[model samples]
Target: MKSLLVVSIVFVLIIIQGTTIGGTRFPTSDENSNEEYTYVEYEEEESSEESTLPPIPTTTSRVILSTELETEGPTIANEFECPTNCKCNKKITLVDCSHQNLMQIPKNLPQSTVYLNLSHNSLKTLNVNDLINCGELRQLYLNNNEIGKIVNTEDFAKLPNLHHIDLSTNAFKPLQGKEFSKARGLLTLILTDNKDIVTSNVPIIQTEKLKTLYLANCSINQLPENIFQNLSSLVALNLDNNPLNLTQGVSAFKPLTELRRLFIPTVPRHIALNLCKNLQVIDIINLSLENHDISCFLLFNNATYEESTIRTDLFKTPTDPPSNSSIVVSTTAPTLSTHIQKGTEVLKQYANAAANQAKTTYEKMSMMYMILSGLVVVLLVAILSVFCIIGSRQLGREISYRKQNYRKYSAGNVTVENPNYERYLIECEKRQFTNE
Candidate 1:
C-alpha cells in the first residue's frame, strides 16, 4: 500500500510536470502558459452554450439604386487610361492632364469633368470625335498647341452646355460656314494669335449670344463690311494687331453701334472721324493717318498720328469743339485756318507797328544824312585848297625849269639849243598874238 501510494504520487507529479514544463527543443514562458490555458475553459463553456442556443433572426434593407444610375449616366474617370502624373479625383470630378507630351487627344475623359485643360501639348489637330463623350464639359483650354484647323464643327455643336472656349496660339485657320453657329450657348470665343485666320464678316450668324470675341493678332487685313451686322449683342471686339485696312468705309464697324470698347491697332482717318458717333472707348496704339481730318477724334490715350497732310477743311466748320480728353495730333500736319488766321492778324499788327517805327527811323536817318552831306562838302573844300597849293608848287617847278633853259641859252653854253630856244620864243609869241 506504501508503494501504491508512492506510485500514485509519482503519476500525479508526472502529469503536473508535463503540463508546466515544455520540451527542451521548444521554449515556453510563464506568461504564455497562463494565457494559453486560461481561455480554454471559457471557450469550451461558450461552445456548449452556442450549440444549445437557437439562431437569432435577422433582416436586411433593400438596396436602393440612385436615379442617376437608372438613366444613361455620365462617364467616370477611372474607365479611361489616364496619362502619368495625372489623377482623376472623384470628389472634385477633375482630370488634370495638362503639359503632358500627349500626341493624341485623351479618350474616355469623364463626362462629369466640367473643366478640361489640354494646353501645352503636342496635339496637331483637335479630333472632336474623341471628345464626343464629354457632354458635361463647359470650359475647355486648348491654348499653346499646333492645332492648325477646325475640321469638324459638329463635335463642338453637340456640346450644349459649352460657354467658353480658348483656342489662343493654336494657329487656327479661317472658320467657314456655320462652324460655330450651332453653339447657341457660347458666349466667349478666344482665337487670338492664330496667324493664318482670316474671318469673313463677323461670324455673327450664330454669335448672337456671344458677348466677347477676341481676334487679336489673327492676321485679319480687312473686316467684312457687314461684320458687326451679326454681332448686335457684342459689347467688346478686340482686333488689336490685326492688319485692318479701315479705308473701305466707316460703315465697316457701323453695325457695332452698341460696342463700348474697340481694340484696333490703327483707326483709319475716316473711321476715326466717324468713330465719335459709335465707340466710347477706342484703343488705337499704333494709329496712322493719310490725312489729319481725324485729329479731332484722337482725344484718347496712346493716340498717335503719323506724318500726314492736314485737310484744309479740318476744324473749318467749328462744329466739332475740342474736348477735355487728350488729343495727340501729329505736329507734321499743316496748321489749321484758325491758327493761320490768328497768326496773320498778330503778324499784321506787328508789321504795322514795325512800319511806324521804320518811319521814325527814316526821319532820323534823313536829318543825319543832311548833317553828313554838309560835313562832306566842307571836307571837299579843304581838299580843293590842298590841291590848289600842290598845283602852285608844280607851276613854280616848271617856271624854274624854264628859267634854267633861258639861262643856258643866254650864256651861249648851248649853241645847238639856241635855235630850239628861238623856235620856242616864236611859238610863245604866236600864242600871245592868237590870244590878243
Candidate 2:
C-alpha cells in the first residue's frame, strides 16, 4: 500500500511540473508576429564636410588613409608627368610621395592633384617653394615624418582650397597663433603626439571654420581660459590621454557651444565626474562615468533646456533675464554615485542662477521697504502737524471766550456776586416818585 501511495504522489508531481514548464508557450509560436516599436529621433543636419573628417576616430597619430597611409597603389605611367620615385593615380589627382625617403619635397607634381600624401618620409622642414605648384590640393597628409614645421602662414594661404591636414607623430616646436591664421576655410587638423607644442599654452587654433581637431597625447597640462573662444563652429574635439588639469576652468570649452563630441578621460572617478558635470558635451559611448550611461539623461535635459529657453525668448522677452525653474528631469538618474554627482552639479548651477535672481529680488524688496518707510514717516509728520494746528485754534478760542466773560462780569458785578436789573430800575422809579 505504501509503495502504491508513493508512486501516485510522484506521478502527480511530474504532471504538475510539466504543465508549469510548457503550458505558457504556444506550440505554434510565430516569432515574427510580435510588434516592434522604434523611436523616431529628430534627425540633425548632416555635417557640412563629412569628406574632410570621418566620424570621431579612435586612433591617434595614425594616418586615416593608411602610409598614403599609402600602401603602394597602381604605379602611373611617365606620360602622366608623375614625379620620379612617386606614384600617382590614373587621373594624376591623388599623388603618393610617401616612403621615397628623399630629403626634400619632390619637384614637378601634377597641378590638378588634390590629395597629396607626403607621409612616412625623412623630409625635415617644409618650404613654401615645394608646395607652390599644388594649388588645387585639398587634403595634405604629412604624418609620421620628421618635418618639424611649415615655413610660414603664406604657404597654407597658397593652397586656397586646402581643407584637411594631418601633421601627427612629428617633432613640432611651440606653435604661435599665426601658424594657420591664413588657412581660413580649414576644416580638420590633427596634431597628435607632438609633445613640444604644449610648452606654455595650446597652439592658438586660429582657423575659425575648423570643425574637427585632435590634440591627444601631447602632455598638455594647462589650458588657457580663452583657448577655444573662436572655435564656435567646432563639432568634434579629442584631448584624451594627456596630463591635463581639467579642474582648471570650464570656460575654456564654453565657447564650443556647437561642439557635439568630446574625449577627455581624467584620472580618479570623482574628478572625471566633476569635469563631466561642468562640461556640456560628453559622449557616454566613449566615456564611462563609473560605468553609468548618462546619454539619455543628457539628451533629455538638453532638449528640455533648449525648448524652455526658446519658449522664454518667444513669450517672455527680456534682455538676458535669468530663468527661475527650468530643471525638467534633473539631468538623469543613472546610478547612486552619478545621481549624487549630477544632483550636486545641478545644485551648483541652481545656486549660481539663483544668486542672479536673488540679486534682483533683493533689490526690489529693498526699494519697496524704503518707499514704505518714507510714506510712513510722511504720514506721521502730517498727523502731528494737523494735531498742532487744531490745538492752537482751540486754545485761541478759549482765551477769547474767557476775556469776553470777564468784561461782562466787570459790567454786571459791583462786588463779587452782584444783583438783578429790573428790581433796581423799579427801585429808582419809586425813589423818583417819593422826591416829587
Candidate 3:
C-alpha cells in the first residue's frame, strides 16, 4: 500500500512538471527547488460547429506563446491557408502580405511559394528562422518595412535558390563579414535608401556569380578597394547619390573588369577619363564640371581604348533564336556605344548653340551693311544736287551776257522807212563803213 502511494505521488509530480509556464512561474522538470506549486490542466470539448467543417491536413505544427496566458492559441501548420486580409493566387503561392499594419511576420505561408512580397509594413526586425521553410522562394521583397536588423545569417543562407533580395528603405546599419555568403546563387541585391550603411558594414560578398548590386542613397562615403575582387561576374554596379569622391578612390573599380554599367557620383576630369574607359553606361549623379570643362570632358570620350566584354545569357529561351545571336549579344558590350551616344548628345548641344550664334551674327552684319549702303546713297545724291546748282548759275550768267550784246547791236542799227529803201541804205552804209 505505501509503494502504491509513492508511485501515485511521483506520477502527479511528473504531470505538474510537464505543464509550461503560462502566467505563473513553475518548477522545471529537472530543477530541484524547495517551493511547491499547485498545477491544473483544462481540456476544451470539440464544438459541433467546427466538427461539421471539412478537416485540413497539417504538415508541421509549431506552438506560439503569447504574453497573455488566459487561453492557449491554435496550432500553426505547414499547410496553412492564406490570411483573411492578404491576397494569394489560386495555387496558394505568391502571397502579398503587405500594408496590413503588421508588427510580426505572418504565419502559415504556403511552402510552394516562389515569391513573397512583404513590403510596406511596420515590422521592426526580421529573424531568418521565420523564413526557413521557404526554400523554393526566389525573390523576397521586404522594402519600406521599418526593419532595423536581421538576426541569424544561417537562416538566409538556407535558401539556395533565392536570387533577388530588396531591403531598401529600411534602418539597417553596416553589415558583418560575408553577411550573405551562403547565398551563392544570388544574382542581384538591392539595399537602396538605407542611409546608415557604411563600407565596412557591406558584407564581404563572396559570390562569384553576383551580377548586379545597388547601394544608392546609402550614405556610403567610400568603398574598400578589394570589396569587388571576388565578384567576377558582376555586370552592373549602381552607386548613385553616394559621396564617393572618385578622384581619391579610382582604384575601387580596378577588379571589376567584367563590369559593363556603372552609376557614380561627381567624377573629376582626370578620373572620369580613366574610369569611363571600360564602362558601357555611366549615369553620373551630380556633375560638378564647369561649362567649358563639360565640352572638354565630352571631347575626351573620342579617345579609343580597349573595352571590357560581357557574358551571354546562358538560360535558354522559349523559342530558339539564331545560332550566333547569343554569342554576338554577349560579347557586344555597350562600352563604346554609350560613350559615343553621350558625347554625341553633348556635341550636338554645342553645335546647335554655335549654329544659332552664327545665324545671329549674320543677321547683325546684314543690318550694318544695309545702314552703310543707305549712307553712301545719301552722300551721292547730295553731291549731284550741288553740281546741278552750280551749272544752273553758270547758264544764267551766260544768258545775261548774250542779252546785253544783242541790245547794243540793236541800238546801233538804224530804223528804215521803206523795206526796199532800208535794205538799200543798210547795204550802202555797210559798204561805206567797210571801205573807210
Candidate 4:
C-alpha cells in the first residue's frame, strides 16, 4: 500500500513539473537566519527531443519590452524613426523622404532601396561614407538642399552604378577637379538655378556617356572655347538665363556635333540663325533688332517694272490727246470723246492678254511634272524586270545541273538521294598507274 502511494506521488510531481515553463524547474528562495533571500538552483536535464521542437515566439516579450521603453513616437527632427502620420508603404522600394523637415537621413532603412529622394531638405551636409552599404542605389536626388560644398569627390566615385544626378539649387559655388569622374555611367546632370555657381571646372570630360546637361541660371558670363569638347554624346544643353554674350566669330559650340537644343534667350534672330546653324529650333523671346534692315517692306508697294529695273519702252503708250488740246478741240468735241473711249477699251484688252499668259505658264509646269513622274516609274519597273529575268535564268541552270549530278550519284549507289536536296557537291578520284 505504501509503494502504491509512493508511485502516485512521483506521477503527480512529473505532471506538475511538465505543466509549467516547458518542464523547466522553478527556483525557491531559501529564508535562513540573517539571510534576506537565496535562490535554490535546480539543474534541469536538457532533452534532445525538446531541442527538435519549433522555437517559441518571443513577440510577446518584445511587445512588453517596447511598452516599457516609453517611446512616444517619431518627432520632426528625429532621424531614427519614421515621422508620425507619414504613410510608409513597406512594399515600395523608393522612399520619397524629401521636404519632410528631416535634419538627417533616417537610420535602419530597408537595404532593398535603390532610389532615395532627400531634396528640398534642411540637410547641410551629406557624408557619402554612410551610403557605401547602398550599393544598389542608382539614383539620388539632392537638389534644393543646403549642401554648401563637396568635401570628397571620391565619396561619389564609389557609387559605380549611379547614373543620373540633380544637384541644382545648392550652394556649390565653384565646382573643382574630377568631382564627377567616378560616376562613369552618369548620363544626365542638372546644376541649374545655383546663382552663385560661376565656373564648373569639374573634370566632366572623362564622362563620355553624359548626354543631357542643364547649367541654366548659374551666373555664367561666358563659356570656354572647349567647354563642351569632351562631351561627345551630349544631345541637349540649356544655357538660358545667363549673362553670356557669344561673339560673332566664336565657334565654341562647333565641337558639339550631336547638340540638339541650345537655349539662349533675347538673341537676335539673324545671330541665332548663324550661331546655331544645325539647330532645328531656336527660342529667341524679346529680341531687340534696332539696326535690322527694313528695305524688304519698301519694295512691297513698288511696281514690278521698277523693282526689276526693266525698260518701259516695250509697254503700250496711252492714246489719249494732251489736256491743252481739250479747249482747242471743243469744235470737234464729239470726235475727241469717241477717241478717248476707244483708247480706254484698248488698255483693258491688253491687261486681259497678260493674265492669260501667266495661266498658260502654270499649266505647262504642272504637265511637265506629271510626265516626269510617269517616266521615272516606268524606268524603275524596267530595271526590276531585267534583274528578275537574269536571276530566273541563272537559278534554272543551277537547278538543272544539280538534278543531273544528283541522279548520277544516286544511280551509282554511292550517295543517298533526297527529294529536297538543294546544295552543291564535288567529288574527287585518285590517280593510279596500272602495271600489266
Candidate 5:
C-alpha cells in the first residue's frame, strides 16, 4: 500500500514538474527580449543627449579653398648675352658681378646699364675713375666688401642720376665735412652692419631727396640732437638693434616732422612714447615695457579723447577778407601728446583682437577633447556590460546543468525500497521522456 501511494504521488509530481519547466523556458526568452530592448533604449538615449550639444564653429565654404596651387617653378634661361663671371638681363639694363675675387670694377659694361651690383668682392676703395662713364646709373650695390673709406665726396657726387646706394657690411670710418653732398638726389641708403660708425656720431647727411634710411645692427649707443633735422623729407627710418640708453635724451627723432615710419631700439615706455608721438608707422618690436606700462597704454584711447577735447568752430565759412588787409592764420598744429595717445590706441586694439582669437581656438580644442573622452568612456562601458552579461548567462547555464546532473545521479543511487527515492526516480524518468 505504501509503494502504491508513492507511485500515485510520483505521477502527480511528474505532471507538475513538466509544467514548471515549460514556464521557466518562457522566462528565458523574455529575458533575451528585455536585453535587446535595454540595448536599443540605451543607444537612443545616448544619441539624443549628445545631439543636443551645441555645434562647434566652422569656417565658411567660401573662405576655404578646395585645392592649393603651388607658385614655385623651375628657373628659365635668359635670352640676352651675359658677361663672363657676371649676369645681365635681356635688356642689359642691370649687371651683377657679385661674389667674384676681382679687386676692381668690370670694364666695358653695357652703356645702358642703370643698375650695377659689385658686392661680395675684395675691393678696398671706390675710385672716381672706375664710375666716371656710368652717368645713367640709378642704383649701385657695393655691400659686403672691404671698402673702409670713400676716395672723395666728388667721386660719388659725379653721378647726378644715382638714386639708391647699399654699402652695408663694410668697414667705414666716421665721415666728416659735407660727405655725401654730391649724392643729393639719392632716395634710399642702407649702411647696416657697420661697426666703426657706431663708435662716434655719424656726420650730418645733406641729401635733400633722401626718403628711406636703414642703419640697423650698427651698434649705435646715442644719436646726436638734431641729427635728423636736415632729413625733412625722410619717410622711413630703421634704427633697430641699437643700444640706446634709456636715461639719455631721445630728441634725435624730434626733428623728423614728416617721418612716416620708425623702427627704434627697445627702450622705456615713456621714451618710446615721446619719440613716436607723431609717426603713422610705429613698430612695437623694439619696445620694452613693464606690466603697468602695458596696462596704461591699453587704457588710453586717443581717438575718443581727442574728439572730446577738440572744439569745432561754430562759424562754417568766414567772409573773405581784403587780400591786402593782413589776415592772420593760426599755424599751431595738434600737440605731440595727442598723436602719441592716438597711435597707442590702435596698437592696443590689434593686441586685443589677437588675444580673443587665441581664446576661441583654445575653447574649441577643449570641446573636442571632452567629446572624444566621452565617446571612449561610453565604448568601454558598453563592452564591459556585454562581457558581464555573457559571463552571467554562462554561469547560470553551468549552475542549472550541474543541478540537473546531481539530481539524476542521486535518484539513480537511491535505495530501491525507499518510497521517497522511488518517487524521485519516477520524476527524473518523466523529465527525460518529456525532453525526448
Candidate 6:
C-alpha cells in the first residue's frame, strides 16, 4: 500500500512539473530583439516553451517556443498555436523562421502568421502551393536565400495582402513585373546587391504603387526609352553604385514626377539633377548618366530648399494592415508610432540637406567671386597698360611740340613765309631806318 502511494506521488510530481514553471526560468527565444514582442508557446510544447533556445523537432511533434518575454507583463503562451521548430507570438501574429537553415518552407506555420521571416536560409525554390496556409501574410522576407526566380506568379495571388517583400542578396533577378504582378497592394521592394543582375533588363520594375526601391550595385548602366514609365508615385530611390548616364535625350527621369529623395554616390561636373532640390555629399556616388556623374534628381534637390511635398507619404507610415477576411494573419507588426520619430528624422534630413545646400552655395559663390575678381584684375591691368601707352604718346607729342616752340622762340618768332635771314635783315633794316 505504501509503495502504491509513493508511485502515485511520483506520477503526480511528473504531471506537476509539466504544467508549472517549477521555479526555473528559461531564456527568451527571439533573435530580433530590436523591437518589443509578446512571447508565446505551443499548446503541445510544455518544458521547452520556457527556453529561448531554438527548439529541435521531435519525431512525435515539433516543439517551438517563444518564452520568458520581457517588456510585456505576463505571458498567455497557452493561447497561441506554434510549432516547436520556430518562434511564434500570437498576439502580434509574428513567426520568425530565420537562421534555421530551412531547406523548405515549414508546413506547420501558425495560420495567423502576418510577418514571416525566412531570411538567411537555404531555400532553393519557393512554390506557391505552400503559401496557401498563410493567406493573410503581409511582409515576407526571403533575403539571402538561393531562390533563383519565383516559380509561379499566380501562386502569389494567394497572398493578396502581401507587401514589403525583401528579395535582396538572392539569385532571383532578371525580373519581369509578372513575378509580383498579383501583389496589387505591394508597397516596397528591395532587390539590392544581386550578383547576377549584369544583364538585368531596362525598366526592370513595373510596379506602379511602389514607393521605396533599393537597386544599389545592380550593374544598371543605361536606361531604356520608357524605363521609368510605370513608377509615377515612387518616393525614395537608391541608385547608388550604378554606372548610368541619362544624356542620351532619354526622359527616363521625367516620369518620376512624384519622386522625392534620390540617393546617389557623387555629382560629376557635367552631371545634372535639376529635379533634385538639395545636395549632400556621401560616399559611393550612384550614377545614372554620363560616366555616372550627375542626373536630374541630384541637380534639382541640391539647389532648392523646397520642403518635401512627399512628407506626408514619407512621414506617415501605415498602421497594421487589416488581416484578410479569409485568413487570420500574424499580428506582430511594427508600431506605427515609430514612424512619427522617423518623420522627425525626415525634418532633420531636410535641415541637413538645407545646410549642405547652403554650404555648397557658399562655396560656389566664393569660387565665382574669386574668378570674377581675377577677370576684373586682368581687365584693370589691360586698361592701365593701354592708358600708360596713350599717356606716353601724348607726353612725347607734347614734349616735341614744346621743343619745336622753344627752337622757334630761341631763333626769334618769325612767320612761316618769312625766311630766318629775311627776318634778320628786315629787323636790321627797320633799326637802320629808325637810326636815320
Q: lDDT of all the models against the reference? A: 0.53, 0.58, 0.54, 0.48, 0.53, 0.53
The digit string of per-residue lDDT tens for model 3 on 320-418 reads 333332112223333434534554455566668899999999999999999999999999999999999999999989866554433232224763233
Candidate maximizing lDDT: 2
lDDT by residue (257-283, candidate 2, tens digit) is 667656553333334444445456533
**Given candidate 5, what's the lDDT at residue 341?**
42
lDDT of 1 at 321: 31
Q: Whose TM-score is greatest here?
A: 2
Tens digit per residue, CA lDDT, model 5, 335-365: 4244344444454566688899999999999
Candidate 3 TM-score, true structure as reference: 0.47
Runs in model 5 with CA error above 4 Å? 1-84, 198-204, 277-436
Task: Check candidate 5 and list the clashing pairs.
Answer: none
Off by over 4 Å in 2: 1-54, 57-80, 201-203, 267-285, 288-436
- Compare candidates 2 and 6 on TM-score and give the better one: 2
Error of 6 at 363 (Å): 43
Candidate 5 global lDDT: 0.53
Each candidate's number of clashing pairs is 0, 3, 2, 0, 0, 42
Segments in model 3 whose C-alpha atoms lie over 4 Å from true places: 1-80, 200-204, 277-436
